[model samples]
Target: MTEENLNTSGNPSIQDVVEQRLSRRGMLRMGVGTAGAAVLGSLSLAACGGGGDDVAAAPAPAPSTTPISLNFPAVAKSTADLVTVPAGYTATVLYALGDPLNAATPDYRNDGTDTNFETRAGDHHDGIDYFGLNAAGTARDVAGSERGILVMNHEALTDQFLHAAGVTANPRPAAEADKEIPAHGVSCVEVRKVNGRFVYQRESQYNRRITPNTPIEMRGPVRGNALLRTKYSPAGTDTRGTINNCGSSVTPWGTFLTGEENWSGYFARSATDDTARGGATAKSVVSLARYGRPQNSASRHGWETAGAADLYARWNISQTGTSTDGTDDYRNEMNTYGYMVEVDAYAPAAAARKRTALGRFAHEMGMFGLAQAGKPLAVYMGDDSRGEYIYKFVSTASWDAADASPANRMAAGDKYLDAGRLYAARFNADGSGQWIELTIANTTIANFANYRFADQADVLVNARLAADAVGATKMDRPEWAAVHPVTGEVYVTLTNNSNRKIEASGSGQQSVDAANPRAYTDAPTAATAPGNVNGHIIRFRETGNEPAATTFAWDVYLFGAEAGMDATRVNLSALTADNDLSSPDGIWFSRKTGLVFVQTDDGAYTDVTNCMMLIGKPGQVGDGAVQALEYTKADGSKLTVNARVGAKPTSATLRRFLVGPKDCEITGITETPDGKAIFVNIQHPGETIAKANIGDATKFLSHWPGNAGYGAGGALARPRSATIVITRNDGGLIGTDGTQVLNGY
Candidate 1:
């Protein structure tokens, strides 16, 4: 997921809180401010000091009787126009952009004259999950490996390659708009092993595409509210489609959960939109502006300029309807997006449901924690924007083991996902945190100064405002999240914040603190982000080892940097040349291997290597200790904060696994039941080519899978986003030698 830089809340920073706490501590020691002692009792002032770095000692690690080891040698970093893996592994291209899903659909010509994209594979493949099929390929079978379904999100378009002569000017032709709209949603294709290699089943009955024009039902507290009433569904029970699908996860009830990210950029609003809605003080105007769609904002692709038909005009969110309830126009269309859409890949006839209980924002993914038989389930999520908050939704119902394989999966989703309590995280200056509930019951939310609350629906629709009122801690562009199979600990990827500074420059800028403590230029004169150019991963253990805990203990798991950089400051995790990385984006743990895989979507460290994936043996959250980091402010003054860091990662613990082709993001990985094979997505290779140079193949930055002989290939073939299956030559388990025993087994 990429950073959008849309957060302009100007909420107080963690650095500001730390400074005040330190001042209060000094006064308490001198017998002043005694009245405030009770309020600060829970705050963990475990480490604090002035000046140079003072490292705290960590406890001895508990020895593992049977340690997991990497069976293959580390792959060297490469800039070559091909996917590079270990010596013993082979990566074969599988499904790709514009591949046919129906048997009658024609093959992609690669010159971009193909039509009927509603039945073709979409662009920018991302966030994939594998669902196993029975031996007869008729039903679900968790143990089946040879034949299954591959569900993935097509995030956005590399539009320059979508048309025959590239994109046309404004007022885009209907033919061009027809292809682009269907290319932005999700795809489910059936795959089976044919001759010792995996291949997509082009003629399978399970293959389906859910695009922006597909119908979706609204579920949960905000379902039929007036805020969702539009010309498409005046009763507020349905909406048109899902857009900007970024990251995804598979549910315990056999459904696919996809996050709608950056959907605000797809709509265009008129300059007089605020005035028509009763000026800036109106609730609708304030809500629209807060979500990055201020009046007169232009759409990303100008889809609204196509024609006056409802198909094209819906992208224009201006309030031009004559009815006061907005029953004749798309004024309320934007409110239906920015949600977590649920899809049952096994059931082809079911429509996707938008679970409105998981409050709206720039959603990254929805990952559930370890499910216990009688405990309330918890789903961890992150909003993918600079200075946004991480969220958790606790289902009101208790988990039942039998529901894992219910006869009706979509009904099971309603039993658990339709009612939940939403909470936003607040990381403290110390190594502890709290989950602030976003409810009207909270006094802060009820009396929020910016927007008046109408009901629970209003609070959820404007979740960002509720989080701001409760003072949730702003993070560095939180993206994908993964839960440890063994410990049930959650780790989130803070994928680089370009708006960070040592001191605030404006409303959206933030300073360094314990959780996000780094501010330096990539190079002396480099034109990258000055603060946190390379991001880090933070992990936490829920209190009492329970998923429903209200508080947790946390630490920085690892920092992203060049291996040769300053050891005390930037390379705090002590990463070696074999495993160093930057801008960690897609992350997941293999349930069978207990190893965490980290993938990068970066521009920060690209000078040394392309975006890559690494395998690591992860330790507990508190495996390392606290360290005070010194920084120079904008005025040249010095400041420091004690940050809890994780253990140093050695070659034995972390190693590079794969590097993708030129200009491609290596995202969305999944494996079969036995873990013998893994599938990965290479998105938008050669995406940096100039729009005017689309006719000249020689000027292309990359011709990726085409050059490597996968699809339509030659020196002149255009690049594409594709999925590749990797397997060991010896037919053994993917990341191991197949002889090692797991801890319990």
Candidate 2:
């Protein structure tokens, strides 16, 4: 759903029920937090400095793990309508929206007249993963990032650049949406570095596209459950392609795990379906409502009005079933999505499989925690919607280094991803946190009054409901999470929330807490936002620094802000022009270099600067102390939280790396193993431009890729989402540790 209308603070209909059970689950949280904190406290105490952060109103200090320091001159702020880089770096546009993936397809015309989307690249590129594929089109045994198959997700579409006159209105046209269908999935292409620059290899054997029309199989706990039965897949064992593929992660076994985000906006429902059964089906209505698809929800493009066959009819998730079991209609079609689908880059012809045991929600990514020999494995996931929960899945099987060498990666995923226990994070007011198990075995879950769960599969299918029963801590739009390569610290980005303290009477929305502390505004766009606008990065370490530990210690690492902002007014980082940023959404850590890569997707600070990417040194926990943050609550109450704060970022530690063109988001950052070449994605440039006035080419909001100094020579007609490669002009490792600017990796 679009940010303008999405219910970011969660479903109001279920808020009261969730709040009533939060107190009941307090004992579990304390028990878990105590043990986790004890383990983290000992391991981190000696590594971190004493409480010595001198910033005023900062969180109380704890022992911090010392991070490798940085030493590059910061880049300057700009609204230059192009990508801006430091003196030694060069940016090259690799592959872009509508660029043909095969030689048989014609080049993009750039005026929306292009067709046969299945043979061309899709729009709105987001998360990406690179699998080192050998010249024979097989997986490379080592981490050979220089030559690999790059798999990236096509998140969404800008109808104006897709259809000749933009998406149709009222009695929507099927032909317009026919072209849109194949534009919303994943893209697999072969790329290699030659003379220090990375380029996509057109027409390579690894080139493939998985669109919404492709076939996919179902696996794990809910594979054949009753809730997944539909007219197209009555057996509930298979389905068609994954849509709204956003931020994804790579499994240790070498497969692309794409997440389905904002999928609730794609299904249509009847206006009277909620009252059709006279409240007998009220439970079904609640499930749909929690997912943001209630009665009469018309869908983002009205794809259901196209036709009546299963091809189009399945888009409508209405309960117009002819049988009592719901097998004769498309009522349960929504359950088919909201899963992490795995695609094998080496085997392009293989069907993608949905790993349902990971649980269903507005999934953003599923990053695996640190993997060690003979240790239990875990993967961290975030539900991107505001006021949602962060989840972790622990595998039933222990880790074996040999599993990573499997010839069939998809088969290896079965031994790990298909069977696991999902846990939801509950961050406490203190400096500790807990990962509550979300199984039906819990008494509160087994006796949940809102929905009746029959078994573990039922609980997994309705993971959101299970989370609500256990009272997980509501967060502020959790987007992407990353594990520190050297420190074993976990970082999650809370990409701002506008509904932090604003609540309806009798509603159960959360107020500002230590875990999600700030509430600021974007006066240029939104007059007042009740939660963190320039979002902060929260980091934690597991008990005994083990990835599978249920307890952990957490603290806010950095709070985003603009230049010259008042420190008293919540510019908590004391930011300068070089290191200031907003809405830190995408993050990555290189174990080899011990550097953190940060990217932005901002609506708050666009007036000051376009979205950009920044680099910083990842430091230890307890480097700083408890901070005293002062702000105004929704009820006009003066509030101050004794929140934990970490080491501050100075000009030498955190610096801007690249700034995208107008209206684009800097997302999806990755690098070669040697750390010489880096790849970043620029998504949906000119997105905020009104579609009606786009016919006037001169009035088009942006002329990017072409305008952004991409000299490859494509038609300079409209702005397109594209992937760009960055390399040091001197052929040195890009932004190495302090005092190594001239050294090769």
Candidate 3:
């Protein structure tokens, strides 16, 4: 959006406000606006209709060898039908909600019969990555290998179905709630493709799970800080489990990094307890409060009352002790989470460590760029909260191919994550942006009146506070981010935020700005609260066209809106039924295929159709900039989005490839290096199934991957979360020359 317009009031549009506040250095960081040109150098669309030269140059040929296509328009009638792909392509249920993590433990009953889940796969699986296999059944990086270790992030539990029955009324029983706590973590399983079918090798030594009770070491600046000390780990040396594991990434060395998000609400802290634990002065309070934790409020699942054991006691964030001398039971234990955790996927039994060096906030996911030897590695992240900032981490040490050894895995992390400076971005009105370093040694951030920092640990523990001190521009809830494989430009999803408005006062009041410009009321739905329900995607290129550069150029790549909405503003590209979407959440750009996968997690338009994923061949950066957005504030004042228009994708160019079942989110995408096969995760299908009928497949909302009739004829077909495989029946490169077979024959 451009920054030229404002209403009667003198207040500048959000774009102008952010531009005025951006440092000159930050503008220079955006490659002085030339980064966009560098990214579009290859795709020349105007000369060959809407398709690129590559498609135009290729000769028209016979149909693909493996006529790949979707098996059905909507395989899932509800949440209970088994989803299938075209014949010759197969689908398998690898893991489901509450599937035990350790084979040493009992297998999942699947008939609403799961009880103990400390060792099982958690619910709501999200982002995932595939690691190739070695000859000796070990994890490796083979470009053409068909077998590998799969690392998946279990974002959170659909507690309504995890227990024997759903959550009881308020002040619920402790044992019932405790059953749901363990089902929220990360799962690593060994998988292989056999004769065109994928199966999980349960007996593989690399198959393991890490839950909330698992013992994990803390690494980086905040490791041993006094604020982190808890009764269970007196020295702040170890913590148990990780929750809210969202989008994740795989390091060049083969380790998996699961992001802990919305982790602050898991504990219960009394008002009196807040004061005893250093009160507001303690970084714990500021950290806890900023992360959405409310004092004296217990989590929806009550694990604190499970028992006197350390497992249950750790969930209590109350200050029960008398002093700060390690005796004052600082219930601030919950603050220790919400950081990026490193899991050794190849060694499933190994404990996952929380990499505090990455800086803690509401992390949605971490995306790593292609690693090059002797070059610094870069990671892009989004804080999944309205008005939060986007961040990136550059490893201090150069990459070395030799560091792939098991012993050197953590060492690689130390070199990259532990020492790098964290940064927040500020987009300028002139189409450029700057990455402001969020370090402690120098800057206005260090003198923040809210929290005092003695070292980098303080800076990380109170990252939001520090960012606020420096006046980093806030954005709509930022979700997943990906770096363009061919262009090296970075794209981020600004998921809808109801709280953002055009006014400066009142709850959820956010002035209309360039980065997050829309503010409109949406029909109320179970998935999202009304206002500003649909979202948009933003893309930028770094200064010097370098991934590690501090400055960059940016623009709104696409806006999410219905076809009937104002095409000039809301529907920037005039997206039609073939490509329109809302609340863009999960996004990925494939390097091998040059195709972008866009998945939606939305509530505003659920009534229209199920959530879907769109496949697109993007044109270039800065294709859809709008100089204004008409947003009326709570007061009488008006607001507008002042963004520089960039090339926008038309409906013909971006089409919906698939739609999920009822109450399900289409997430976790990865593909073979050759781009011949694609994998996607269908999470929490039939989630709306009533608690009373959880065990009955007939009445349940979904029975995916399990044929519908089979579950009704006295067949005990259990609904399970699964990974689906999609490959062309005539086996050919996907999306090549726009002639790839689609919509199953």
How many backbone overlaps does candidate 1 show? Answer: 0
Q: Arrange candidates by lDDT, highest first: which order?
A: 1, 2, 3
Candidate 3 deviant stretches above 4 angstroms:
1-92, 98-107, 169-178, 278-283, 325-330, 370-374, 401-407, 525-530, 632-638, 689-699, 707-719, 737-745
Expressed as tens digits, the lDDT of each residue in 169-245 for candidate 1 is 88889889999999989999999999889999999989999999999999999999999999999998899999999
Residue 334, model 3: lDDT of: 73
Worst 10 residues of 1 by lDDT: 47-56
Worst 10 residues of 3 by lDDT: 47-56
Q: Which of 2 and 3 is ahead in TM-score? A: 2
lDDT of 2 by residue, 509-584 (tens): 4567778776656676457545566778888888777767999888888888786766755677777888999888
lDDT of each candidate versus the true structure: 0.82, 0.73, 0.63
On the 0 to 100 scale, the lDDT of residue 318 in model 1 is 90
Better of 1 and 3 by lDDT: 1
TM-score of each: 0.92, 0.89, 0.84
